[model samples]
Target: MSKHTILGETAIQQLLLDLPDWKVIENKITAEFVFRTFADAIKFINNVATVAEEMNHHPEFCSSYNKVRFSYCTHDVGDKITDSDLKIAKQISELARNLNGKSGY
Candidate 1:
Protein backbone atom coordinates (compact mmCIF):
# COMPACT_ATOMS: atom_id res chain seq x y z
CA MET A 1 0.00 0.00 0.00
CA SER A 2 1.08 3.58 -0.61
CA LYS A 3 2.48 5.29 2.43
CA HIS A 4 -0.13 7.99 2.11
CA THR A 5 -3.06 5.63 1.84
CA ILE A 6 -5.45 5.89 4.78
CA LEU A 7 -5.37 2.85 6.99
CA GLY A 8 -8.48 0.94 7.89
CA GLU A 9 -9.47 0.15 11.49
CA THR A 10 -8.07 -3.37 11.44
CA ALA A 11 -4.83 -2.28 9.82
CA ILE A 12 -4.39 0.54 12.30
CA GLN A 13 -5.17 -1.74 15.23
CA GLN A 14 -2.68 -4.32 14.08
CA LEU A 15 0.03 -1.75 13.58
CA LEU A 16 -0.67 -0.31 17.02
CA LEU A 17 -0.13 -3.68 18.66
CA ASP A 18 3.59 -3.13 18.25
CA LEU A 19 3.23 0.41 19.56
CA PRO A 20 1.83 -0.14 23.00
CA ASP A 21 2.02 3.46 24.06
CA TRP A 22 0.14 4.77 21.05
CA LYS A 23 -3.62 4.92 20.67
CA VAL A 24 -5.90 5.88 17.83
CA ILE A 25 -7.94 8.87 18.84
CA GLU A 26 -10.05 11.01 16.54
CA ASN A 27 -8.33 9.53 13.49
CA LYS A 28 -4.80 10.19 14.75
CA ILE A 29 -2.29 7.99 16.50
CA THR A 30 -1.21 9.69 19.72
CA ALA A 31 0.97 9.06 22.75
CA GLU A 32 2.12 11.04 25.73
CA PHE A 33 5.65 10.63 27.04
CA VAL A 34 6.76 11.74 30.46
CA PHE A 35 10.35 12.30 31.42
CA ARG A 36 12.02 12.58 34.77
CA THR A 37 13.09 16.13 34.01
CA PHE A 38 11.94 18.94 31.78
CA ALA A 39 15.32 18.96 30.08
CA ASP A 40 14.99 15.30 29.27
CA ALA A 41 11.61 15.93 27.73
CA ILE A 42 13.10 18.69 25.60
CA LYS A 43 15.89 16.44 24.49
CA PHE A 44 13.39 13.79 23.39
CA ILE A 45 11.45 16.42 21.48
CA ASN A 46 14.60 17.60 19.72
CA ASN A 47 15.41 14.07 18.69
CA VAL A 48 11.89 13.62 17.42
CA ALA A 49 12.26 16.80 15.39
CA THR A 50 15.38 15.53 13.69
CA VAL A 51 13.81 12.20 12.82
CA ALA A 52 10.60 13.81 11.62
CA GLU A 53 12.60 16.15 9.40
CA GLU A 54 14.58 13.30 7.91
CA MET A 55 11.37 11.40 7.20
CA ASN A 56 9.53 14.55 6.06
CA HIS A 57 6.64 13.60 8.29
CA HIS A 58 5.77 16.03 11.05
CA PRO A 59 3.69 15.33 14.16
CA GLU A 60 1.39 17.48 16.17
CA PHE A 61 2.78 17.74 19.68
CA CYS A 62 2.53 19.68 22.89
CA SER A 63 4.89 19.79 25.83
CA SER A 64 4.29 20.84 29.38
CA TYR A 65 7.01 20.63 31.96
CA ASN A 66 8.20 17.03 31.71
CA LYS A 67 5.48 15.65 29.47
CA VAL A 68 5.16 15.59 25.71
CA ARG A 69 2.10 14.45 23.82
CA PHE A 70 2.47 13.59 20.14
CA SER A 71 -0.28 13.04 17.62
CA TYR A 72 0.44 11.77 14.13
CA CYS A 73 -1.76 11.74 11.04
CA THR A 74 -1.43 12.29 7.31
CA HIS A 75 -2.95 15.66 6.66
CA ASP A 76 -2.69 15.22 2.91
CA VAL A 77 -4.92 12.21 3.29
CA GLY A 78 -7.57 14.19 5.18
CA ASP A 79 -6.07 13.83 8.64
CA LYS A 80 -6.24 10.07 8.54
CA ILE A 81 -3.76 7.55 9.84
CA THR A 82 -1.32 6.18 7.24
CA ASP A 83 1.84 4.16 6.99
CA SER A 84 3.93 7.29 7.39
CA ASP A 85 2.17 8.11 10.64
CA LEU A 86 2.74 4.61 12.00
CA LYS A 87 6.40 4.71 10.94
CA ILE A 88 6.96 8.00 12.69
CA ALA A 89 5.10 6.79 15.76
CA LYS A 90 7.46 3.85 15.95
CA GLN A 91 10.46 6.12 15.58
CA ILE A 92 9.15 8.45 18.24
CA SER A 93 8.51 5.52 20.58
CA GLU A 94 12.05 4.35 20.09
CA LEU A 95 13.40 7.82 20.72
CA ALA A 96 11.43 8.07 23.94
CA ARG A 97 12.61 4.67 25.10
CA ASN A 98 16.22 5.62 24.40
CA LEU A 99 15.86 8.91 26.24
CA ASN A 100 14.20 7.36 29.29
CA GLY A 101 10.87 8.93 28.56
CA LYS A 102 8.05 7.01 30.18
CA SER A 103 4.85 6.55 28.23
CA GLY A 104 1.57 8.15 29.35
CA TYR A 105 0.76 11.36 31.16
Candidate 2:
Protein backbone atom coordinates (compact mmCIF):
# COMPACT_ATOMS: atom_id res chain seq x y z
CA MET A 1 0.00 0.00 0.00
CA SER A 2 1.11 3.59 -0.61
CA LYS A 3 2.36 5.52 2.34
CA HIS A 4 0.71 8.75 1.24
CA THR A 5 -2.92 8.54 2.19
CA ILE A 6 -5.81 10.94 1.78
CA LEU A 7 -6.20 13.45 4.55
CA GLY A 8 -9.44 13.79 6.48
CA GLU A 9 -11.23 17.11 6.90
CA THR A 10 -9.81 17.80 10.35
CA ALA A 11 -6.30 16.84 9.32
CA ILE A 12 -6.61 19.08 6.30
CA GLN A 13 -7.63 21.98 8.51
CA GLN A 14 -4.60 21.43 10.74
CA LEU A 15 -2.35 21.26 7.71
CA LEU A 16 -3.61 24.64 6.53
CA LEU A 17 -2.85 26.10 9.91
CA ASP A 18 0.63 24.57 9.91
CA LEU A 19 1.35 25.75 6.41
CA PRO A 20 0.43 29.39 6.62
CA ASP A 21 1.48 30.10 3.01
CA TRP A 22 -0.95 27.50 1.68
CA LYS A 23 -4.74 27.45 1.43
CA VAL A 24 -7.33 24.96 0.27
CA ILE A 25 -9.88 25.85 -2.40
CA GLU A 26 -11.99 23.46 -4.46
CA ASN A 27 -10.45 20.63 -2.47
CA LYS A 28 -6.93 21.35 -3.62
CA ILE A 29 -4.17 22.83 -1.53
CA THR A 30 -2.91 25.86 -3.42
CA ALA A 31 -0.23 28.47 -3.25
CA GLU A 32 0.96 31.30 -5.47
CA PHE A 33 4.61 32.21 -5.72
CA VAL A 34 5.99 35.40 -7.16
CA PHE A 35 9.48 35.95 -8.44
CA ARG A 36 11.40 39.05 -9.41
CA THR A 37 11.35 38.15 -13.10
CA PHE A 38 9.76 35.78 -15.55
CA ALA A 39 12.95 33.80 -15.93
CA ASP A 40 13.19 33.38 -12.20
CA ALA A 41 9.64 32.17 -12.07
CA ILE A 42 10.21 29.62 -14.80
CA LYS A 43 13.35 28.39 -13.14
CA PHE A 44 11.52 27.96 -9.89
CA ILE A 45 8.74 26.12 -11.65
CA ASN A 46 11.21 23.76 -13.24
CA ASN A 47 12.78 23.09 -9.89
CA VAL A 48 9.37 22.41 -8.39
CA ALA A 49 8.47 20.10 -11.24
CA THR A 50 11.56 18.06 -10.67
CA VAL A 51 10.68 17.61 -7.03
CA ALA A 52 7.10 16.77 -7.85
CA GLU A 53 8.19 14.13 -10.31
CA GLU A 54 10.48 12.64 -7.75
CA MET A 55 7.65 12.48 -5.27
CA ASN A 56 5.33 11.10 -7.95
CA HIS A 57 2.79 13.78 -7.13
CA HIS A 58 2.35 16.29 -9.86
CA PRO A 59 0.67 19.64 -9.32
CA GLU A 60 -1.38 21.92 -11.51
CA PHE A 61 0.77 24.86 -12.56
CA CYS A 62 -0.38 28.18 -13.97
CA SER A 63 2.22 30.76 -14.79
CA SER A 64 1.94 34.32 -16.03
CA TYR A 65 5.00 36.52 -16.22
CA ASN A 66 6.60 36.50 -12.79
CA LYS A 67 3.71 34.87 -10.97
CA VAL A 68 3.02 31.15 -10.68
CA ARG A 69 0.21 29.33 -8.98
CA PHE A 70 0.31 25.69 -7.90
CA SER A 71 -2.57 23.48 -6.88
CA TYR A 72 -1.93 20.02 -5.44
CA CYS A 73 -4.53 17.33 -5.02
CA THR A 74 -4.82 13.58 -5.31
CA HIS A 75 -7.05 12.70 -8.21
CA ASP A 76 -7.05 9.05 -7.19
CA VAL A 77 -8.44 10.00 -3.84
CA GLY A 78 -11.48 11.90 -5.03
CA ASP A 79 -9.49 15.08 -5.79
CA LYS A 80 -8.77 15.69 -2.16
CA ILE A 81 -5.65 16.65 -0.27
CA THR A 82 -3.32 13.80 0.61
CA ASP A 83 -0.14 13.20 2.54
CA SER A 84 1.89 13.39 -0.65
CA ASP A 85 0.39 16.78 -1.38
CA LEU A 86 1.42 18.06 2.00
CA LYS A 87 4.94 16.70 1.60
CA ILE A 88 5.34 18.13 -1.88
CA ALA A 89 3.98 21.50 -0.77
CA LYS A 90 6.49 21.66 2.03
CA GLN A 91 9.27 20.82 -0.36
CA ILE A 92 8.08 23.45 -2.83
CA SER A 93 7.78 26.03 -0.07
CA GLU A 94 11.35 25.41 0.96
CA LEU A 95 12.54 25.61 -2.63
CA ALA A 96 10.68 28.89 -3.12
CA ARG A 97 12.29 30.31 0.00
CA ASN A 98 15.72 29.29 -1.24
CA LEU A 99 14.99 30.91 -4.59
CA ASN A 100 13.88 34.16 -2.96
CA GLY A 101 10.30 33.68 -4.03
CA LYS A 102 7.50 35.65 -2.38
CA SER A 103 4.02 34.54 -1.40
CA GLY A 104 0.72 36.46 -1.25
CA TYR A 105 -0.65 38.84 -3.84
Q: Which structure among the candidates has the greatest TM-score?
A: 1
Clashing pairs in 2: none
RMSD of each: 1.6, 1.2
Candidate 1 lDDT over residue span 1-105, tens digit each:
455878899999999999999998888899999999999999999999999999989989999999999999898778889999988899899999998888893
lDDT, candidate 1, at 87:
88
- Candidate 1 matches the true fold with a TM-score of 0.94
lDDT of each: 0.91, 0.87
| Deviating ranges (above 4 Å) for candidate 1 | 1-3
Per-residue lDDT of 24 in model 2: 88
